[model samples]
Target: MKNEVITIDLGSNSFRVLKYDYLNFKIIDEYHQVTGLADGLIDSGIISFEALNRVVEALCIAKDKLNFNPNNAVCVTTAAMRKAKNSNEALEYIVKNSGAKFKIIDAEEEARLTLLAIKYALKREKIDTQNFTLLDIGGGSTELTISFEDKIYTKSFDFGIVTMTQKALKDGKLFEDLRNQEIVIKEFLATLDFSIKDFPFIATAGTPTTIASIKLGYSYFNYDKNVVNGTILDIEDLENSLKLLKEKSLEELVALVGKGRVEYLEIGTYIYKLFFNVLEKSKSIVLDDGLREGVAIDYALSLK
Candidate 1:
C-alpha cells in the first residue's frame, strides 16, 4: 500500500489542505478556504478572535471531509502566525476545536519550501532552471528566490496583498500606496548585489495563477490547472487585465477569482505588475504549485 499523508498550509489569506500519496508524489485531493487570517493583522499585530475561529472552522471541515489522521498530517502556518502576538493561543484553539496541530515556520523555512516546490515544478515541466528568479506573492509576505550561476539566494518581504491592501485602505490612498510600493520594490531590488542577467522570471502563488486563469477564460467553476500552470503572462496583458478587473464588483469578481479573494485581487494585481516592471521582464511563467505542495514534497524526501 502507498503511504498517504495530508499537508495543510495555514496561510495569511487562506487555509489549504492536501491529501497526497507521498510515495508516488501525487496529490489525491485538496481543499481551500479563504479565511483571511491576516485581514486586520497589519494594523493590530495580532490574529483576531474571528480569524482564529475561521481557521478552526476550516480545519474542522478538512478533518471531516478529508478523513486523514492528524498524526500523519503535516500542517504548517506561515507569515500571519509568524507575526501574530497570539499565535500560540490561536494554535491551541485550532487544535482543541479541530484536532489539527500546526507548526509555525519562520521566513527562512518558508522560502526554502517555496523554492523546493518551484524547483520540482520546473523539473517536471522540463523548463530550464539553470538561472531564474522565482517570486511568490503571498497574503502576508512576498518571497523572492534567485538561482543564479549555481548559487541560490532568497529574501522575504513584509508586505503582501492583504497587508498592503489594509495599509492602503487605512491611509485612504489605494492607488497612491500601490504606486509607492512599486518605488519601494525598485529601491530594494537596487540594493541586491546579484546581477540579474537574462534570468527567466518565474511567478508562483495565487495572484499570477488567478490572472492566468482569467486570461485563459477560466472562471471559478471551470479552472484548468494544466492550462494555467505553464502559461506565460505578458506585462501588457497583465496591466490591461488589472484595469478591467478594477471595474468588476465583488459579485462579478467572485465568479472569476473565487470568493474571499475578490477584495484583494486588485491590489494583488498591482503588486504583481510592479514585480514585472521592477525586474524589467516582459513576461513571466506562472506555476500553481507552492508551499502546500512544497511541504508534501519535503516530507516525501524525508522518508527516503
Candidate 2:
C-alpha cells in the first residue's frame, strides 16, 4: 500500500500544499493560493490581521483537499513568517482556528531542504550534479548553495523579491544600490572559493524558473519536467526580458505576467539581473521544484 503524506508550505507570497504518495515517490495532488503574507511585513514588521485571516482561509481550503486527517499533515512556514514580529501569534491563530500545526524553519534548515529538492529533481532528470551552484529566490529571502565534490555550502540573504521591490525598486533605488549589494553578495560567495568555471548554476523558485518558462514561450505556466531538467537561459535573453519589463507600469506588468505577480516579477527580475552580473561566466539551469518539494521530501524521510 502507498503511504500518503501531506505537506503545506506557507510562503510570503503564496501558500502551497502537496499530497505525495510516498511509496510511489510522486506528487499525487497539489494546491496553491496567493495570500501575500508579506504585504505589510516590510512596512509594519508584523503580519497584519487581514493577512493572517487570508492565510487561515487558505489553510482551511488546503485542509479540505487533504485525504488524510489533520494529524497526518506536515506544515511549515518559511522566510516571511520567520521574520514577522507576530509570527507566534499568527501560528497560534492557525492552530486554534485551522487545527493545523506549522513549524517555522530556520535558514539552515531551509538550505538543507532546498539542496534535497535540487538533488531529487536532478536525479529525476538523470542530470549530472557533480558541480553546480543552486539558487532559490523566495518572496522574503533568497538562498544560494554551492555543491562541489559532494559537499554543499549555503547562504541565505535578507534580500527577496517582495522586500527588494517594496524597499528599493519601487523608489527607483534598486539600480543605484545594486552594485553595492552585488559586491557584498560577491564577497560572501567568494568565501566558498568554488570555481564558477567548473560548474553550471541551477535556479529554483518562482522568479528564475518562471522567467525561463516565459522566455521559452509556454502558453501556460506548467512546470514541464523536461524544461526544468535541462533548460538553459542565455544571459542576454534574460537581461532583455528584464529590460522590457522594467519599462512597463504596474498595470502593464500585471497584464503581461498576471495579477498577483507583477510586483514580484519586477523584483525577481532585478535580483536575476544582479545574479547575472555577478556570475557572468557561468550558465544557468532552471529547476521548477524547491521548498515545497523539499518539505515533501522531508516528510517522506521522516516516515521511514
Candidate 3:
C-alpha cells in the first residue's frame, strides 16, 4: 500500500498543508491560508501572539480538511520561525494546540529543497532544466538557484517581500517617490555576478506566482496549476499590475490580491519588476510549486 504523508508548511505569510503520496511521488491534495506568521518578527525578534494564534487557527482548519487524522502529519516552519527570539516557546505552543511536531530547517537546506520542487515540476512538464535560474521570493527570504554550464549554484537573500516592504515602504504606500530604492536593489544585485538575461528564468514561490496569476486574470485563490505552471509572465505585466495596484485602497486590494496577501503584494510587484527588468529576455516562466512541494519531495525521497 502507498504511504500517505501530510506536510504542513509554516511559511512567513501563509500556512499550507500538502498531502503527498510517497508511492506516487505527487501531491494529492493541498490547502493554504495566510496567517501572517512573521508579521512582527522582524521588529520584535519574536513571534507575536497574534501570529501564533493565526497559525494555530490555520492548523485547525488544515487538520479538519483531511480524511485522515492530522496527528499523522509532519509540520515544518521556515524563515519566520528561525528569526523569532522565542521560537522554542512558539513551537511548543503549536505542538500543544495543534498536535503536530514542527521542524525548523536551515537556509542552505531550504535552498536545496526548493530545487527539488523545480526539478520535479519541470520534469513533469518536459521542460528544459539544462540551463536556467530559479528566483524564489518568499515572505522573509529569497532563494536564488542557477544551473549554468552543467553546474548548479545557489544563494539566499535575507530580504523578502515583508522585510523589504517594511524597510523601504512602511508608509503603507506603493512605489512612493523613492528613487533611492532602485539604487538599493541595484547594489544588492551587483553583489551577485550571474546574468539573468543569459539563462531561462523560472520564478517560484508565493510572490512571483501571485503576480503571474493576477496578470492572467485568475480570480484570487482560484489559481489553476495547469494554467499557472510553466506559464510565461511578461515584464510589462509587472508594470501594469503595479500601476493598477497603486490605485487601490486596502479593502479593494484585499479583494483583488486575496485576503492576507495584500500587505506584501505591492512590494512583491516591485521586487518582481526589479528581477524581471534584469532579464534580457522580457518574460519569465512561473512555477506554482515551491518550498512546500520541496519539503514533501525531500521527505518522500528520504523514505526511499
Query: Which window of ten consecutive residues has the lowest lDDT sum in model 2?
Result: 219-228
Clashes of 1: 0
How accurate locally, in lDDT, is each candidate? 0.86, 0.78, 0.78
Q: What tens digits encode model 1's per-residue C-alpha lDDT throughout 232-261? A: 999876886778676877688888889988
Descending-lDDT candidate ranking: 1, 2, 3
Q: Distance from true position, residue 273, model 3, in Å?
A: 1.7
Please name the candidate that would achieve the greatest TM-score relative to the true structure: 1
Which residues of candidate 3, in runs, are more than 4 Å off? 169-197, 279-281
Residue 82, candidate 2: C-alpha displacement in angstroms:
1.8
Return the lDDT, model 1, position 53.
90
The residue ranges of model 1 lying beyond 4 angstroms of the native Cα positions read: 174-194
Candidate 2: C-alpha lDDT? 0.78
Q: Which of the two, 2 or 3, has more lDDT?
A: 2
Q: What is the C-alpha lDDT profile of model 2 across 85-195, one tens digit per residue?
A: 889998898788777788999988988888888899888878876778788888998888888887878888887888887877357787776677788788887897557
Better of 1 and 3 by TM-score: 1
Q: Judging by lDDT against the true structure, name the best candidate.
A: 1
* Per-residue C-alpha lDDT of model 3 across residues 1-304, encoded as one tens digit per residue: 2587888878888788898988789678888898988887767788888888888888888777865455677777788888888999999998888777898988777778888888899999889657887888888877777777756677666777877776664555445523454555456557666675667889987777777777778857577777889888887878777787778787876776788787787778777776666444578898888777888888888988
TM-score of each: 0.94, 0.91, 0.89
